[model samples]
Target: MISISETSTQRLRALAAATAAALLLAGCGTAEDDAPTDTDVSASPSAISLPVTPVTIELVDPGAEPRSSLTYEPAGEQSVVLTTSSTVSQQIDDQAAQDFSTPEITLPLTAQAPESDAGGEIRLRIGTPTSADQRLTEALAVAEGSEAGLTVTDTGAVTALSISPNADAEDAARAAIEQALNQAVYRSISFPSEDVGVGAVWTTEQQVVSGLTLNQTTTATLRERDGDRLTIDLRIDQTPESATLELPDDAGQLAIDTYTMSGSGTLEFDLGRSLPVSGEVTVAGEQQYSDPEGTTVLRQDISDTLRWSTP
Candidate 1:
């Protein structure tokens, strides 16, 4: 058993190391300080476009017995790889990391699922910023808690994520899962892009350990030229679980085939060309999970609208 303090220490060390490396690499480039290149787009005054991108969630439970660590390693092509490992053992702690943002599930296991030996890694190539990520950057540049459109609190850490918890156990769990997915998309957006003047590029690849075959597609749309405001929309879908958890051969199952997550918001970047961007996120989606029966399961839909902010 590991103490919470110990777990925090280990995580701090890993975060420190990763942050240092990323910063060192970032130092090679000059910072953007001048007035932003404002490309005002005419978007529908009431609509925001969602971006399609995969969001990865690694769970870390700092308790008497530590669960796992979220690690970020540099990959070729200026990309970063994220993986999670259990503090208890060397095996990649999938359940822990995957379930972190969600509530606890105490279902009794009736049948033992076969252990998988498949091992692969997911990579997010950070080349250019996407429209959603860039819009977020602008929103962050001048975001205030009062007008963020979503309720958000800054914990003063390397990341700021939203938590949309559903009151129902399963629903809450699904909300957390959705939040993680959105954050993963956010990570893709976080990477600065040289190709676009004011957006980020997001790419994803899934690696499996044994029997599971996984593939996900994500896309995002950012428009600010409809009426006089900016809107960002994002959507992500995974192939449905099959005998091997591959995309279901049939399309009807496709609805339940892959896990679908999405989010969108209206952003106001008209503040004096300086700080303080405001927006609200109104998003919804379904969460897929394996039940105590080990049968592929799906939870009720989850959605929310809250204020958001960045500083």
Candidate 2:
């Protein structure tokens, strides 16, 4: 396993760019008033807390060893492309798959976005099985898998990002180009997804993350400035839960019982304007299987940030 130091931890602090912050503007309106002066106007930070949720579904195992990474791409007016990749590994009981038709599992993941001007394709492959499903009833039966354990490794990659001339963006493009030159800003962007989607992922709550597994419960508050900017303050947490993987008992695979976990963190964001963000995470989890009942558990606390920009 890889070791983490204070210096490495501070670098991770930059990951907060992934979450944004708040921007408030002051204004006033009056009937028959030709114009308003700053003397008569004042704006306060919005105190309202609206619901917030996650736009993408991610499957993660916090206990796995952290993966090393490299990013490379060309830059210019021609066409730019960016690529990112990370790997994770964990130990699992071999008998866990006895009841299932297959010996594999599936997880939700994210692909990195390339540089804005990079016109490249983004693709995600399991690097193993592309898809698999287990019966809910079968999942509930086995409390644990066999005594023998196996090593599992997984990788996620974002292969491309594209940028192009926008005829209609003459206005927005101009504003972004101007802003990009001076002040640094972080923006939180959201996209609708038909698969692995959440009903309201932007809520405030705590989250628990285990080995490639995540459970979150939260409440979120959000305020929007026209359609351009949004401010959000939220609490998120992840913990392990008792998950049972059931396969046909006749399949001779080990039944598996998952350990439970939980934790919470604060997340703040800026829609169009970027701000520095920081937070912490704590979680615990273990893996076990039926028959001889073997177990593996892990616990950790983490904090990190990344440069973030959204459109």
Candidate 3:
């Protein structure tokens, strides 16, 4: 029989490759000079009304980028496309008082994926600046641990990312902080269009491959304007899919079986802040795999929520 340890090692490497590909992005903010400012909104005490005509989605906001850890080529065809769907919601409480002076933000997040795949429904709460730095420190520890089979470090990046940058943290701590900082910077997508009016539609597509043979075609439509907020509808056409496996050294001819997956959701972007307030998405599908061992089946019925708020 194949060594279980070897199999685990190979599987982890494959998953890591797939993850990196799916989370492709450029670097993010690091210097104290990179702090974010509240542009595109009203400075007055009262809330401002929605903008007229077309509106654009800012992709380079200092503090509003999504975070990622892994890095790889975009997913491609003749590979697996791992699909992800999200349903995020946001609400503003006018009655509750909040301090606008702080740069901190708390975002609630959830995710679900198949076991054979590299995903499971995970519920996580993330806070910006310090909390974000701390979480990265923990993850970095795992990645650099002797048993973690790693040999990389970036402690300085962690210090730079912290609300209180600490250049003195250990190598593992810094590496983790940098990793977290990278992800946050990547989330801030740079979209085009000066103004997107009601009924206007936009699409974001990538020809790069992250690992899986798949599509990431997404369409967003300006659905409605309810006073201070704008509702946007979204549809995902493909997900990242790819697999790295270790077959018997002398294994013969091989065959692969694939399946179908699809999903839809909505995003609530605040007209005032021009940021996604909240939204929800649901995705369902089934997949099958086979080999000399016989056959294996996988099914996915996953849903998730994303919310953003501040006072």
Clashes of each: 47, 67, 45
lDDT of 2 by residue, 1-311 (tens): 11134442222222111110000000011111212222211221111111112233232211112221111221221211111111112222221211101112221112332345433322211111112234422331221110100111111111111122122223322222212211111112221121111222333222211112234543333322223223333344444343432122122222335433333333333222222122222222333434323332211222212222221
RMSD after Cα superposition, model 3: 19.2
Model with the higher TM-score, candidate 2 or 3: 3
| Tens-digit lDDT track of model 3 for 1-311 | 22225463344333323323223211122222233332222322211111111112332212212322111111111111111222211111122221111111222222111122322111122222232245543433332211100111110001111212232345444333333323232222223333444565566553223223344455666567555465767665554344422222342211224444445677664423322356544433333333434332212222222223332
RMSD, one per candidate, in order: 23.1, 24.6, 19.2
Q: Candidate 3, which ten residues in sequence have the lowest lDDT sum?
A: 148-157
lDDT of each: 0.25, 0.22, 0.31
Q: Candidates ranked by lDDT, best first?
A: 3, 1, 2
Instruction: List the candidate 1 regions with Cα displacement exceeding 4 Å.
Output: 1-188, 195-218, 225-233, 236-258, 266-276, 287-298, 309-311
Predicted structure 1: lDDT = 0.25
Arranged by TM-score, best first: 3, 1, 2
Which run of 10 residues does model 2 get worst, by summed lDDT?
19-28
Task: Give the range of the ten consecutive residues with the poorest summed lDDT in model 1.
Answer: 83-92
Candidate 3's TM-score reads 0.39
Q: Is 2 or 3 the stronger prediction by lDDT? A: 3
